[model samples]
Target chain A: MATDRIRDFIRTTRPDGPCLVVDLDVVRDNYRAFERALPDSRIFYAVKANPAPEVLKLLADMGSNFDTASVREIELAMEAGADATRISYGNTIKKERDIARAHALGVSLFAVDSHEEVEKIARAAPGARVFCRVLTSGEGAEWPLSRKFGCVPQMAVDVLVYAHQLGLTSYGVSFHVGSQMTNLDAWDAAIADSKYVFDKLARQGIVLEMVNMGGGFPTRYLKDVPSAEAYGQAIKGALIDHFGNQLPETIIEPGRGMVGNAGAIKAEVVLVSRKSDLGENRWVYLDIGKFGGLAETMDEAIRYPITTDRDADEMEPCIIAGPTCDSADVLYENTPYPLPISLTIGDEVLIGGTGAYTTTYASVAFNGFEPLRSYVI
Target chain B: MATDRIRDFIRTTRPDGPCLVVDLDVVRDNYRAFERALPDSRIFYAVKANPAPEVLKLLADMGSNFDTASVREIELAMEAGADATRISYGNTIKKERDIARAHALGVSLFAVDSHEEVEKIARAAPGARVFCRVLTSGEGAEWPLSRKFGCVPQMAVDVLVYAHQLGLTSYGVSFHVGSQMTNLDAWDAAIADSKYVFDKLARQGIVLEMVNMGGGFPTRYLKDVPSAEAYGQAIKGALIDHFGNQLPETIIEPGRGMVGNAGAIKAEVVLVSRKSDLGENRWVYLDIGKFGGLAETMDEAIRYPITTDRDADEMEPCIIAGPTCDSADVLYENTPYPLPISLTIGDEVLIGGTGAYTTTYASVAFNGFEPLRSYVI
Candidate 1:
């Protein structure tokens, strides 16, 4: 957690090119720590966060289940020796082949958001287990998948009853409040909704045994954000409180929380320029531009970039843009640069907070630079 | 451009899976169209748009130059049979290896943005053909390379003088206003800036033979965007006005404008649901979400979907979202879904306007999806 430790890691490594260095020790420890925190509930490692087979293998080795949203991801988890029974295909938008593949792989658990998906699964994989997805409300919830995927609570009850009539066993209820969720009350409300569905299904003589609280526990993107442990405990406590003792063998899928801070992108500075017209500035262009690993922040607000140049003290403000011709390419806005830091032409800079949705989520095509060569600690 | 024609392509081919379908015929037509429109100017096919060797070969066969920004891309163009002398390394960020490789490959034309870059290139590729990039104020000028790479006009004069002193030939002046340019006046303004730089270099006793008017001609995103022919002619006429009979040999690099509409993503409609709260709304989720090919639309608003459902006339408004669990995964918002369209559960939807940046430039990580399968049409 100390800057000195990161500095030491960078100094000893001295990478020859643009790359990503991952502390496998930190990652494995983080995985094990999350699992230890929720010993009672099964952990479905969300593969969408970081789908590297090695990482999946690490989680599988740690006795963690996986939540796959696609057929190929399911295949990857299974190839990594994940328990087929423990694998849950949680995607609401299901292709026919996807369902058949999951069924062929003996994956019993499936997430169903629409009645159309339920019918498709029934026709394709008649014996697979299914769960009801309920829609809950929240602000900044732009384009809610609930509106696009899940049915109303009453509609979900009808789907469950219809499943029972069609000889399909409905064993669980699942709801995703949203990603980067800051409201614990949203999770609490979703848990309450799941209980209502559970009771309604029970009235129809159907007993549910699983309640999947889909993961969205935020990683502290900035200071003052709640820690993952605090987020996890709050949700877990709500699940227990809502369902009392019959919480249906709870399962939590924490994607970003487990891997968001365990890695960093290491890039070398390519150029440094000074501009007087743009409010007096110094600019450092790195070889690791929007093409390499910073593509996500290409046009958003100011991105946070830190210099790895050693023995620096005085600071100045400068803009960091990528090498691509696209005007949209920028790494950060008028960002601070340590002025006294003797930034030679070819110094190094480490782009931090890139562990979760970076290499595993984005592509590098601008300069034909693939994701950085990842090194496990 | 008929709906039936697109459907024929998808149904007849039944390719392996979701992949890039590059219509070589369409690309060749685009290439020849641009060449014929600006018969006098040089056309440098920006390989960053579609680095597939065949595409490069098609352009190279037609007597076009290659615009590369990295050592890897330059080498790829060469491997694809591009003449070393005809390739211009227009990258602003110069790595040590990049300069060395350009020198080794005998690619003389280069874009120099900084005095340090000039020094590095002079040391590495001593006799390389260099162009001093200048900043131009225009309507769409943003994320200016001048901020990261270009020298000021005065500094450019100094750099040109210094390069002459170092026995390095300053071949020309180059400037990129921006990408996806809608304002054609930006091209005129850039040419004016190029003339100023050329004149200043001439005063410094650095005679130039070429004026590289950097790329960013508009491609048709919406119907109202200017046609390539109109924009190309406007630029050509402006170059003639600025340089008159002594007009230097010209070079133009077009990435998206060349391949933007040459291909599309054909995805199947997987799940359909209705939003009761949002009124009588129906949502059709595609098998190919953001990962499949909708990655380019993640930033700007772009929707070029063509429904193959036979009942196209019965169109209605529907929101389409990708299959990813991320809440921000809406592919198209409030788009009209034609009725009588065959977009039932398993029908296919061809997403157009994806030929340029969507294939290689977008995110391809989650779902373990393969890159767009490319086929020469």
Candidate 2:
């Protein structure tokens, strides 16, 4: 949903070209809700989701820690008034030089999923604290974090042992149920796997200190999702069942959930027409597309709710495409999107739940179109 | 293949981070080849493939016309020393305002596939020369452009008729065989479709003057494609068979064929590891991934030949991925790529056949990594 502030900003300013408008108030509320839901777990805002300076500054003011994937993100966090202790290098795949750069910038927490990554961190960051990420099934996640990321639980044990031997603190275990995960019980199996790793490490006299639960919290899109309180209760029940009252320090990295529903994209219909007189569906072209900012719509996975001024008119199915010449820029074709029959060229539409991944996924200048502009109010 | 100049530049400068190096000499040579192969057809270099200033300047200096997708691309071509007469607003889907802007910039040639688009040009550019694009089967292209662009052949005739009625010059018909088209006969059916439109419009007293044979020229990747001379001969044969001695003025757009082999990307191996002891293949993480510049690997469609220092060593299948935290960044996983067994972290590898569609497709900063840097020498 577009917050009142965002809607008013667009109605008044009327910025040229397609752009995303984010309401900081909505983000602030989302942050507070997460804090209330998971009071025991520290919130580390994932910088990759939406690293706009205003978003970073607001979250930093709220005392949120930062989960960064690169040295540039760590610098962005630090620049937003966060200290080095409040930043964690959370990407499991990193060059040794990047690891050293993060260490030099005072980042002490690092993530590792492989022996190679562990070796790099050990050589570059020395005695940094490392958390081993165990693989998850990602069954219920719309955007599954596939096997390309974490390792098997058994391999995580070996990775942690190697880190302990290399003088790096084997901090704990972590797992992601995947982005836009909907199943409340998705965290139960992962928490059990973390407990297994913890028990195996403890038997070797190497005690882990924390359990870093990677981000999976979902934001409302075309469908309603489980509330943050429901996710917190489900996760808490899993933690209690696995750890038996000896709970480890917990941390949650929320990327999309914190910012996804806080912004909206304003785009105009570029052209609308049928291929032939008997063509089945009309093709509606917009200024923005896969290369512009709506990349999460790849494969039509994340279908954002679209609202046009002519919503009261009779609706008709239409294929939505971007303004670029590339055929792959079609946003919705497998399942045609229904739009008002009265919709015409130059009509304005608002796409909701686009705050998180939209801006950063935009191409630099594909077809001479500029990257998605962001206006934080 | 990376030309000697590009390889030498990379070896000597050793630029930091993953970067693309384009050899202007190779681009010049490619332009010469296209001219020699299709002596009767004018060449319009598609700017969307590689809009680098040096590339545009080289083509412009060689008397090549430009097919631009947006107003900025038109400005870029003009800045590169091309006159407005040599530039065509080639994208069929455009905002009316963009059409007006391009017209204001003195661009008189436009492309339209639908009556709605034709109307936009008619209102914005008044009497601009317009071409109707007919749909093709896209049978033999590796990257098959689906029905997102172009219209049925019959509809193209209607569109051209409408453009002429609205005071726009119904100049001709156009169709793309699809990008990276490998089949030498792929243009035959499209050329036939254009001839049908010509005959249909001629009966209506709106004689089409040109057949804008759009870009589909292939670039060599892992497999060798038909040469420019072979494609030229096949296309010329199709034109002669269709029109006999009454062939219209012809224009061919070549984007990838002009620059795909002229550039190479220098990337570093970030990490290499297996998930478990029983895992079948190793995972090789590179500093660059789909979001970095290799977006054409969306479904592992374009497999560029990679060369490493240890290429002579024993080879094994590996799942290659980027350094981002996103799981979708994996380049080749369904069919793992075979790499040298001795390849290790920090090793330098060169990805060839990346001159086209690489830099422009890069995300601004997906995971805090900057957009793909380009160095044209």
Candidate 3:
């Protein structure tokens, strides 16, 4: 279906300039594959992944619950008609006002790590149901969730006990294996940790009804990356192994893995220059740079650069940079693509897999460039 | 006077939230110092460095010219009461519409890297003066300019001849030594290349009056980093060597070098935690991130962190990160400092020397965080 939608839905939103293209066909398949792999699991689409109202609306329509970390994200999900009972406000909440506001809006569940946060939440929202987030090992993973927020395995039990004393039921146990997790065992290990915590809490008269296995299933960018289906299978098997038939309502939040491959960043090649570094090696330069949004997400040195369909035959190693004066604004280095052709001034080049973070995260607002307009088909 | 004024006049301008504190007195002194070093040279405060109009107005009052790279910057400088005639639209002009706009705005001096750009300028702003940016070696510098824009010394001569035929006056030659240049020889090499280009252009009947040596003088965050005076002196001495007293309207643009040390980014420490990464280490997460600015300007890890005076006694090495969910949103790593003792739930921490690139160029309009509110005292 995704492949079919790609063929049929080449819809154009903006007449000219950068526009975010979302292929719902890809999204529908991504959701279905994730669902089939982990049947009977409650899926909470992390709203932070692609918070575009349209994207959220589609996910909500497909029976995907929302995992909101911030008050604003919860509001956006609510605006899309996501039922209050379906939202999980994971406990890494900072400001007290936000916690109270969430409670006032009838948000029931939360993620709690520290006692300070526990007391603050209890005082603000007394009847709020909560999850004690357990911090798992971040070995082999680039971004570990244990650093800033989350409770240690021992701390999770203590915090759960503390919440019970405060008349709040510990409804679930949540753990994030971290973002862009490529290692399948990382999820397995987190599940193992969650099981240990869940069993301990059960002996203390706390019945865990939910297991929030946070999403880090990386969407394949280049060749060699695992598909979303493979990631979903790994998580499903892990959940089944530990919890068996008595498995709690399962929830997984996949951010980039869900929407990364759905769109491309289209930019115009304003200037191209050739330079021989030492003896006879030449490099081409494009007009866009780090300010174009690729640099901030993928660290500027684009790991995977597939030549656009139009420019595939014109292959040459070119260094692309933003038009901004800053030098670190380089986009790609020594990219192999065809050139010496009429790919001159104002020619368009589409950088792939940029839909997720490129537009939403890093951009230059000072230059009067509006946010890349988004379109959903 | 600078220190006293900073203490008395500078305060966070936002009604309530994270903000930056800029000392106008130090900024003005830095401007005067750079101007004094290059006695005969005109100074253009590179608008791309820190474009806060309050900062611009301070520099404008202290008699600084502007090197604008975009239409927005040009408009900003004009709004700050900078004489439009004293501005030069530097290298990195990508769009043809941008060139046309620059010309229509009365920006006479423009840097042309390609024949296409030259034609665009000729058609758009026919009587424009031009500076053919020559790409020279600054091999070890953090961001080498030649890798992107500029003409080879040999190609530059041809470009000069082309501009001469097009009726656009090729007034001078400009070359950047690169940002954060530690080696004084970079300036030496660029000046030497300028001397060769100046002589070659003179023979072709072009009276080369100005030799613009672009910015990137280092600031005083690290101990051994050279002072602005040393950098200015080195450049001043080189210009005199190349053209003697005949140096035509010598111009220099010192962006980060002047402002980087004078202002600091103050963020509230929302949370602090310790995690074992090979060993146990404390992590300090802030309310701001790369999206807030200071994204990539830092070449290496910054160990120097200033907490609020109240927390001065409590110092520790903490990994500072932004509030964003993205993994790459790290501000500082393995940074050891005394954990400020008095710092509590809502105290601020000062990140020094973030004035230049942080707020000016790199910022993502995500999470609904607003443009940086600036305060100059």
Deviating ranges (above 4 Å) for candidate 3: A1-14, A91-93, A132-155, A158-168, A276-288, A300-309, A312-314, A334-342, A364-370, B1-14, B136-146, B182-185, B222-226, B276-279, B297-305, B311-314
Q: Is candidate 1 or candidate 2 better by DockQ?
A: 2
Fraction of native contacts in model 2? Answer: 0.94
Reference-based TM-score of each model: 0.90, 0.99, 0.89
Best by lDDT: 2
Model 3 CAPRI rating: acceptable
Tell me the docking grade of candidate 2. high
lDDT of model 2 at position B313 = 98
What TM-score does each model's chain B reach against the true chain B? 0.88, 0.99, 0.89
- How much is the lDDT of residue B272 in candidate 1? 73
lDDT of 1 at B242: 85
Candidate 3 Cα RMSD after full superposition onto the native fold (Å): 3.7
Q: Native contact fraction of candidate 1? A: 0.50
lDDT of 3 by residue, B104-176 (tens): 7778888876666777777777878888777766675654554566767767777767787898988878888
Error of 2 at A86 (Å): 0.9
DockQ of each: 0.48, 0.92, 0.36
Candidate 1 lDDT, B286-330, residue by residue in tens: 666565456555532454645465653566667777767665567
